[model samples]
Target chain A: MSSYHLDHLQHLESEAIHVMREVAGEFERPALLFSGGKDSICLLRLAEKAFRPAEIPMPFLNIETGHEFPELIDFRDRRAKQLGAKLIIRTVDDAIARGFATPKPGIVSRNQLQTPVLLGAIEEFKFDCCIGGARRDEEKARAKERFFSFRDSFGQWDPKNQRPEIWNLYNARLNQGENMRVFPLSNWTEMDVWEYIKKEQLEVPTIYFSHERDCFRRGGQWLPVPPAHTGATTPDPYAGARPTEKEPVKRLVVRVRTIADMISTGMIESKVHSFDDIITEISAARVTERGSRADDKASEAAMEDRKKAGYF
Target chain B: MSATISHSRPPVSHPVDILRFNTCGSVDDGKSTLIGRLLYDSKSLMEDQIEALERSADITGGGQINLANLTDGLRAEREQGITIDVAYRYFATPRRKFIIADTPGHVQYTRNMVTGASAANLSIVLIDARLGVIEQSRRHTCIASLLRIPHLVVAVNKMDLVDWSEERFIEICDQFNEFLPRLDIKDVKFIPMSALNGDNLVDPSVHTPWYVGPTLLGHLETVHIGSDYNLNGFRFPVQWVNRPNNPTDRQLHDFRGFSGQIAGGIVRVGQKVMALPGGQTSTVKEIWTLDGPLPEAFCPQSVTLVLEHDIDISRGNMIIGLDQLPGTGMDLHAQVCWMHQRPLQRGKKYFLKHTSNTVQAMVTEIDHRINMATLVPEPAPAELVLNDIGEIRIRTAKPLVYDGYATNRLTGSFILIEQGTNATVAAGMLLPSEQLVRPESGDYVI
Candidate 1:
C-alpha cells in the first residue's frame, strides 16, 4: 500500500539496526566505540532497538584523551550504567604511562595519541570488531570508508585495498590479530543524527546544548579553557599552548558541533537549546560538522592517516 | 514573500523519502565535475568545503576551479586525478533526500561499479557527447541492468563543447536504444547538459529551448520509487531470535520472537504462514517494532514477529506467507560476479550466505561468462577471474528458501565467502526456480 513507505529517518534507522544485528550474529567479540557524542548516542538507541529485552551482547569502549569534557565523561558513564553495559575506559595517559607513547613537544591535543591506546585495548581484549560512529559525510577520507572497514594485524587501514561491499551482505571475514571497524551510521548525515535523536527522544551530553563557558580564540576557532585543577598527575592537556594576552579569554555562549577532547574541540556560538533548535541549526550550517574539529585542520589527510594507524 | 518565508525553514520540514543512485563514466568524461556541478548548483556544498577546494592547488582546465577535487579525496587520487574508491555524497531537496554513490569508471574497477550499483535505485550513465556511446557507457549500462537498477539516466555531458546540438543528443540516445532492450532496465531518460558550465543541471538551460524535459534535479526529486520494493510474496529471513527474558518485566519474560528485516511482501498479524526447510505452518500472533506494535509490516521494514505456537524457528529459518511460497531446494543456479583474484572454477567449496543462512556450497558447473563488450554469453568459460560476470551452478549442503533475483533482490541474492581468508569471492543472483510448490513433507500445524 501507499502507506508502507518509511520516512527518511525511519529508513536510516532500520538500515543502522540491521548493521548492528549483523555484528552480533557474526563476530566472536564486538564492542561499541562510545564517545558520548550525538552520533554514538543514536548508535546506542539503535543497538537497543536491535538486541533489547535481551542485553546488548557487547561492551562499550571509550578511548579517553584525558582532555575530555567532564560533562561528556559523566554522560558516557551514566548511559553505559543505565544499559547495564560494561564500560571500558582506556586513556591516552595510561598509554603514555606504559611507555607506549611519547608526547611530542608543543602538541597539546592527545587526539593523535588516542591511536596506540585504542590499538592496545583491541589487542588486550582480543576484540575481533569495534563498531564506530564514523559517517561518510564528515570527512573526505571517511567518505570512502566501507561499512566493514578491514584493518590489518597492525590495525592499519589500506584504503586502496578495501574490500568491495555489495548489497546488504558484507564480507566480515578476517584473519587472526586483524579486526573490523564497523560504522552503522556510515550513510547518516549530521542532520539525520539530530533528526533521529529528536524522533527517538534520546538524551545526549549537556555540552551539545548551548551554555556559558570560559573560552579563548585560537587559529580562528574557540577552545575551552581547561579547569585549573586539570587532573593533578597527568600532564596538562593545555600545557604548551595557553591563550596569550593577544587572544583574551571571553565568556561566550557556545555549544559543540562535534564532541572530542575539550582542548581540540571547537565551540560555535549558538542559541540552540533543544533538539528542534539543533536540527534547525544544522540544516542551515554552511560549514561541515568537522570544520569545528581542530584536530582535522592539522593536515588535509589527517583523518585518513590516523585511521590507517587504528584511530576510531 | 510566503515563498521567502518557507525557504528559511529547513528542506526537511516535512517527511521526505530517500533515493540512492550512482554516477558512472570513464576518465575525462567529467563524472566528478558533473557531481560537483549538481552539489554546487543545488547549494549543497558547504562554505568551508568550497574554500578548501579553492585553496587546493589541484586546479586544472583554464583556472575555472576544478570541482572534482571535492570528491577525489584521497592523496593518490588527487595526484593521479581519478577516483580510486566509492565516495558517498549526500544532498537533500524539499521533496527527497539523495545518496550518491560516486563510483570509479575504469575497466579494472568493474567490481567497484557493481558494488556501488548494488543498492542503488537509479543510475546516471554519463556519455561524452563528442565521443557518443563509448565502451565504458555500454559496460556501465550492462552492469546497471545486471544489478537491476529500476531507473537509468543517460546524461549526454559536455553539450557546450558540441554547440548544444539536439541531434547529437538524439544520436547518443539512439546508440543506447540499440542495446537497451537486451538489458533489464525499464525506465530510461536522456538529458543534454554541460556539467562544466552548469547547463541543464538543476535549472533548465536557455540554450536548449528546442529540447524540453525535466532537468536532472527535477527528475531526481520526482522519480516514482514507491513501487521499487517487492510487495507480493511475504519473505522474512530470520536474522536474530529476540527473547528478552527479563525477570523484572512480565511482558518480556517469556517473549520468543523472530527478528529480521522483511525481505519481501506484506505480513500481518493473525495471518497463516509457513516455515521453510521443515515446512511447518503457524499463525502470526503479533508484529513488534521499536516504536510499538503494528497491524501489518511491509517489505524492507525490520520487526520482531511472534508466532501462535512454539515453533523451532531460529536465526537461519525463513517465515513465509502461504499464498506465494518460495523455492526450497539444495541445488542452485545463479549469476555471480567474482570479486577475488583467485579465479573461480568447478569443485571449489565456499560458505554461501543467502539471506541470513550460511551453508557449505560447492560449484557444480560454470555455465557462461557474459562478455561486456558484446553483451553475449561466452559459453563454458574455464574460470571467472576477478571482476568477471558469469553464470554458475552450485550445490549447497542444506536447502534454502528463496525467490528469483528478478522478483526480489533481497531474498534471491547471496554472497560466497572464502573459508581461509574470509574474503567475499562472489556476489550471486539466484535464477527462477522451476518448483514453486510446497516441499515433500507438508506438515501443516493448522
Candidate 2:
C-alpha cells in the first residue's frame, strides 16, 4: 500500500492545476479573474502551483464594479504588488461613460455594469482566455456551464449552442475575435475553497471574516452598510415597509454572508467572525450564498440569463 | 466537520463543499420531484425559486409546487413534462455540498448519462414503485457500474403512489439483487420514499417506522467516499512545461519542469519513477504545491513535479511508479459503450482521447455486444450502436499507458472521438484479455 489516504483536496487541486496548465499551454494570452474573494484567492494559489518557483506569467484581471468594498481594493492592489504580477482593472464606471454599458437612471446596482467592462477589458488586452473561479455548485445556471465556456466577439454566450468537450482534452480552438472562459475550480465546492485557503494559508481580504458593520433591513434580512445609491424600488427605498412619514433609521450591527457589490449582496446577523466561525455558521445556515444576490434573487434564470449576456 | 472525514478532509475546504451526484432513471420515475423534495426539505432553496415552482406548478396535473420543476428548469422541460437534456441543480448542507445532475430517463440520452457520471463519484439510480425493475433501470445500473461510480444509492421513489407498501419496495430490491453479483459494486443503499409528500428525504417520515436506515440527506452526508478515489497507483499525465520566459528573472531562467496534477498516486521527493512510452527513469527532485516545497504530492492533487534528471517528457505522457509502470501498446481491447448515433463499424477511424492525450484510433474489431438492458452478451454482433455496450478491439496510432478500469479509473477509462467531426463517440472501460493471455506479444485490448 502507498500508505496515503484518499486526498480529495489534493485531487481537486491537481484537477485545477492541470486545468491552469492547460490554459497556459493552449491559449496565447490568458488572464485570471481576480476579485480578491476566497474562490479567486484559491485560483491565485493554483496559478502559483501551475508555475511555481517562478512568477505567474498571466495577468490578474478585475472588473471593478466601482461600488467595490474599499478593503477589497486595497487587498487587491497589495496582493498583486506582492506577486509582482500584472493587475488589469477595467471599471464599469468607465464603460458607462463610454456608452458601452448603461444602467437604468438612478439604479443602485453596478453588477450589470460589469459585463461591458469585462468584454472591453478582453478586447483591450486581446486575451484569448480569461480564467475565472466559478464553481458549478454555486448555482443552477453555473452548473450547466462547461469548463471551457466560449464567448463571441460581441461577448455573448449562447448556452443552447455550446461545443461538447470530451475526455480531459478541452478544444480551446476559437475563431478570430473569440475568447474562452476557463474555470479551473468548476468541480470544487464552497467548503473545498475554505479548506484550500486554510491549508495554503492564503492572505485573503478581511471582509470574508465576520465583522460588525452598520446595517438596515431588507427583504426580511439585514443589509450591512447599505449602498448610498438606491435601486429601482420605491415602496421601501431599502429597509422594507416603512411607517407613513419615516421609521427610525436603525443601523444594527451585522456581518455580510457573501460579499458581492454592495448594491446586490445582502448581510446577515452572524457573530461568526473568523474563518472558523464562518464555516460553522455556514454549516448550520439553511440558505445558499447566492440567496442574497439581489440579481439572482430577482429571477430563477437570472444568473443563466446574465451568463448568456457575457456576464461571468 | 464530521469526525470520520475531518482527518481526511483537507483543512482548507477548497472554497466549496459541493458534491456532484447524478440520478439516472426514465420518465415517471419522479427524478425531478425527488430533487424538489431534497431542495425543499433541506431548506437549501430560496423563497424565489420556490415561488417560481408555485407559479408554474400547473405543469404537473395539480398546481402544487411540482417538485420535478426544481430540476426540470427549462421551459421546454416544463411544457413537455419530461427532462430532455442533462439538467443540473445546486443544493448544500453544512455537512457537505451537492450538485445533482438529473439526467433524462429516455434511452436516447444515454450519452448524457455518460457525461453526467464521468465526473461523479456516486450515482443515485431511482426506480418507480409501480415499475419494479425495468430495462431503463437496469441500463442505468449497468452504466453506473461501467462508469465506475464508487457508491450507489437506489432510491425507490413514489412509494406513496404505491401506498408506501414495503412489499413493492422489497420486490424491486429483490429484482435488483439478482444482478449485483456479476459486477463489482461496494456499497448499495435502498431508500423508499414519496417525493411528492417529502417522505424520508431530509427527515425520516413517521409512516415508515418499519424502515430504519438514514434519510436521503443523512446517507448523502455520511457515505464512505473516503476510499472511493483512485489513490493506490501513481499516475501523473504531464499537462504542461512550466518555464518562466523572463530574461531578467535569473532564478527562473533555466527552470524547465513538467507540470501536471497527480492523477492517481503520491510522488515523493527522491522517489524513483519512470516515464512511459520512452521508458526512461528518474528520481523526484521536488514535489511543489501552491505554497512551496512539500514532502510528497499524491493523487487527485495538482502539483508540479521536478525530476532530478532532464528526461524527455511532455504533455500526454505520464509518470508512474517504477514497480507499477503501466503497459504500453498501440492495440487495445476495451469494453466500450458506443455513444454515437452512427453504429461503431470495424476499421473506422476515430480520435481516442485518453487522459490529456488525443490520438488517432480505429475500431479494429467488435468482439461482442453486452446488451445494457438485458445485461447479457450478444457475442456475435457486427456493430455497436448508440448506448450499446460491447467488447471492441481498438488500434491507436501511438502507444497508450493504461490500467484496468477496475484498478484505476483515471488511467483505465477513455473516450472515442469521431474522426471527421471530432465528436466524442464512445466511452470504454477496459477488461484484461487477449494479449494479456500471452506473455511477450505486447498486445492487449480491454
Candidate 3:
C-alpha cells in the first residue's frame, strides 16, 4: 500500500498533466505560452507527456520583448522547431511601432509593454484559451488566481469575482472575445520546478548556470550589462536602462534565477553550476526569486495591478 | 550480530510527500494570522516577502505589522482589512510539502469555504479562545463535514488573551464535541495557541504545560493522508483521446489511447474494465505515465491507457472495474452550494459538469436547505440563494455514472454552469443514487 503513494513532485506533475489534457479536450482553439524560461520549459515537457505519440494540439505563443537575451530567443526557437510546434512570436517592438502600446517616460523595462502584444496576438489568432506557465507561488496576486482563470474580452482579470473551482472540475466556458488563461502549474513552487527539471532531465538555457559576465549594481540587484552594440543603425536598447548614475558597471560571476527580460531580471552571485547545487542553494535561500525582479518592486501591489490590467 | 556501519557519509533523503489542508474561521479569529505565523516560524518566509509586509504595514497604519497583509494581496482586501477570496499558500518542511488554502470565514463567504475545502484532505477550524465556540465555528465545522474533509483541527487561537488557561481550552473543546458526533468527520484535534505570539504553531509552546499533544506543525507533518483516496473501486473518467497517426513515425501511425487521471483504485495492464453507458468491456493493453510504461497505476496519477480492442469510447465516459459498479441514471439527488448572485430554483437549467463530462441538466425540485446554526434541515426552502447549501433533485439529458459523495469526492462532485452566462453557479455533491425514488408512471411524480 505504501507503494501507492506519489511523492510531492509526482503529485504536482500529475495535477499539471491533468490540466494540460483538459485544455486539449475542452478548447476549440488553444495556445501554449512559452517564454523560453524554466517554468515554460517544464510546461512543454508536461504537454509532451500529455499528448505524446501525437503532436501537441496547440501552437506555441511568445510575447517577445526586444530587450530579451539573444541566447533565450535562440533556445526558444530551437526547442519549438525540435518539437515540430508552430511557434508564434509577437513582439513589443511591433506593437509599439503600430501605436498599439505607448511607452511610459523614463521606463526602459518594456515589461508592461508585453501585455498589449499578448492581447493583440490573442485577437489575431482568435485564441479562446492561452495556457501559461504562471504559478500561484510566483506572486501574491497569483495566490488568489483560479486554475482556469476567466478574462474579459480585453484580457483583464477581475480579482474580486473569480469562479469557484470545485473538486477537479473546471468551468472553461466563454463567450466570444472572452478567453481563459489556464495555469497548469498553479500549485507548484520554485523548488518543485527545479526538482522536476532534475527528474525529467529537461534542458534549460545556459544562463541559469554560474558564469562570469559584465554586470552592474542597481537598486541592490545585479543586472547583466547588455553586450556593447556594434555600429547597427538602430539606437542602443540598453541605453538609459540603468536609470541612474549611481549604478556602477562591474564584472561579476552571477547566474539568473529567473528568465525574464535581461534588463528586468536580476542575478545572484554564486558558484552553483549543477542542478544539485542549485537545489541546495534554493533550500537555504533567504529571498523569493521575484525579490530580485525590479519590475515587481515598482510598488507593493505592482503584480496585482498589472494582473488586473491584463498582464499574465 | 556483528555489523559495520558507514559513518563517513549521510544517508540519501527520500522524496517528500505533500499535504493539502485549509484554514477557515471568522474574520477576527486569526485565520490569516495563523497561516502567516506558520509560514514564518517554519522558515518559509523569504526576505523580500518580509520587506513587502513591512512596507504594507506602514500604509495600513497600526504601528504594528499586520501578518494578514502577507496573504491579502489585492488592494481592496488590504484597505478593507479582510480576506475576500481564497488564497493558496505553499510551504515545506524537510519532512513534507504543504499547500494551505486560506479561505475567508465571513458568513456571506460560505461559498468560498466550500470551494477551498473541496480538494483538501484536512481542514483547520480556528476558534477564538476568548469568545469560546460561536455560531461561526459551528458553521465552519458543518461545512468541513459537508465537504467530507477527512481530518479537522480546532485551533483555539488567541490563547494569550485568555491567559493560556487549560480549563478554557477544555471548555471550548467540550463545546465543539457536543456537535461533533452529528457531523461525518472522523478525526478531530483541539489545540490551544496564539497565532500572534507564535505559540504552538511550529514549536510546542511552554505556556501550555497542561496540553501534551504535538504542535500544529508536528501534527501537520505526521498526519496520515496516504489513504485519503478510495482505493477499492477503480474509476477513470477519460479526459482526452491520444492518437498520433504520424506518417513518418512507424510505431505511432496506428496509436490510440484514453488519457486521464485515475479517480479511484488501481489498474494494471491486461486488466478487464468496463465503460459506462455503452457497457462495453475491454482489456487494458498498456498503462503509460510520463516516466514510462507502468505495470500498474493507482488513483490520482495521470496516465494514457491503451485498450486491447478498439471500442467506442470518448471524453466524458468512465472506465471502471466490473465489480463495485457505480449507479447509472438521469435522476441525481445532490447537495449544492449556490455561488452566483442569481438564486437557484426549480425549473432552472444548467450545464452539469461531473468528472470530465458536461451535460444539460434541469432542477427538478428543491428538497431542503440545511440550517447552519443548528445543523438541521429546513424542509423545502423557497430557493437556494448565494452561499446556501441545499438538497435538490436534478434530471440530466444523459445518464451519469457516479457514487455517493461520502464514497468518492472525485466521482460524486459536480459544478453547475449557467448556460448563457457560462458562469459557474453552484458546486454540487451527489447523494446516493440508489436512494433516488423513481416514479413508475414517469409523469412528474414526487
Model 2: number of backbone collisions:
39
Off by over 4 Å in 3: A242-246, B1-15, B435-446
lDDT of 1 by residue, B1-446 (tens): 00011223244564489999999999889889888888888878887787777667434434346889889989889878899999999988878889999999998888888889999999999999999998789989988998899999999999988999989888899999999999999999999998887888989998999878999999999889999999999999888888878899898898898888899999999999887766778999999876788999998988889999888988788999988878767789999999888988689889998888888999999999998889899999999999889999999987778899999999889999888888888889999877674744553221
TM-score of 3: 0.96
For model 2, what is the error of residue A45's alpha carbon versus the real structure, in angstroms, after optimal superposition? 2.1
* Residue A279 C-alpha lDDT in model 2: 66
By DockQ, the candidates rank as 1, 3, 2
lDDT against the true structure, per candidate, is 0.87, 0.74, 0.88
DockQ of each: 0.65, 0.27, 0.64
**Cα RMSD over interface residues, candidate 1:** 2.0
Model 1 per-residue lDDT tens digits across residues A175-219: 999999999999998888888888888989989999999899998
Q: How many clashes in each structure? A: 1, 39, 0
Model 1 residue A88 distance off true place after TM-score fit, in angstroms:
1.4
lDDT per residue, candidate 2, A1-312, as tens digits? Answer: 235543446657767777888888778999999988788988988887778777786999999877677888999899888888899988886887889888766666777778888988998989999999988767766766778887888888776555444335576656789999999988776666776777777887877766666655566556555445455564323332222233334555566666677656676766765667666666555456777767786666677778888997
Instruction: Give the CAPRI class of candidate 1.
Output: medium
| lDDT-sorted candidate list, best first | 3, 1, 2
TM-score ranking, best first:
1, 3, 2
